[model samples]
Target: SVTGNRVAHTANIDRIAARGATFHRHFTPNQICSPSRATMATGLYPRHHGLWRNGVALDGRLPNLWQALSLAGYATKGVGKLHFQPLLAPVERDMPESLAYWERPGCEDWHGPYFGFDAVDLVMGEANEATRAGHYAAWLKRNHPEVVDLYEPDANPDSRAQDLNEVWKSAVPPELHYTS
Candidate 1:
């Protein structure tokens, strides 16, 4: 974890922690991203938030921290992988966080107000090429089309041969990485 005492190569994360706050005794409502993030936003357990698992959407009607902050006259913005909704659900569901919505006709114009955020700049998933879908992808396509194709899994054929099946080095250069 980024907050681990002996963790290395997390200077940026550490700086943020220093500037604000870090939890020493953290308790999570769910193990996964969506449910956990929802818990943080709504200050409610998964059952109360109506998002018990990954693919389920959080009920928009529920009061959340972002909305509360907005109502309190703060501008709320989200960046990167919010994961508040399914990244691969059907497009008809109107899940703006999903790749389906990001691939639509005018998705490039979408910046947010989504799920109580006044504005958002989203990236749907991790650095994996297959899941590269959102504003970041659009920016990459527009500005670095030459290397975008290299992000595909097959671009680095040896990536899948690692001892840990889920571990693979991406062919996308560090300079072009989502976190870059």
Candidate 2:
């Protein structure tokens, strides 16, 4: 579906692809999001990257594309959902700063040579849940506080993976959505 029929909202895609190279056959190492993304970031299989599932944590020892980009002085930056880590985990009340959360409160300040990116504006969740927290939310909160409520919060923290099309439809307006 990357190409074929064009929608009114994505006419620019056709225009751009017409001006550029097009790929007819491309495939990912894995089918799922997190593992696939891990493979993409490292240019290695999920087994080699050691993050074979959604909730798995990627070890920092491995070389990722962003780290390489940063090392090359490219001013590495990610402007959208970078699901580099797990979303949900058991929270210990003792450790206030566990790495369980990706789009947490202070994560906007974490520009990195750490992951290979010098600056990032990430949003991982799908549809309505994309507004949970990230650079987009932080920017919305800082620049447009009055419209913050329009981007609906994730009501169910433990909501299992399923089609939530109805829920998403009843969620935020596109103009108010804060995902980068």
Question: How would you encode candidate 2's per-residue C-alpha lDDT over 68-165 as one tens digit per residue?
Answer: 87788788777666666665654542111123443345666765444667766666565555545655656667877766555443433433335233
lDDT of each: 0.78, 0.61
lDDT of 2 at 146: 64
In model 1, where do residues sit more than 4 Å from their true spots?
1-11, 14-25, 129-131, 152-160, 168-171
Best prediction by lDDT: 1
Residue 158 in candidate 1 has what lDDT? Answer: 62
Q: Pairing residues by index, what is the TM-score of model 2? A: 0.68
lDDT tens digits, residue span 62-150, model 1: 89899989999999998878888887789899888887887689887978797778999888777554346788888888898877887
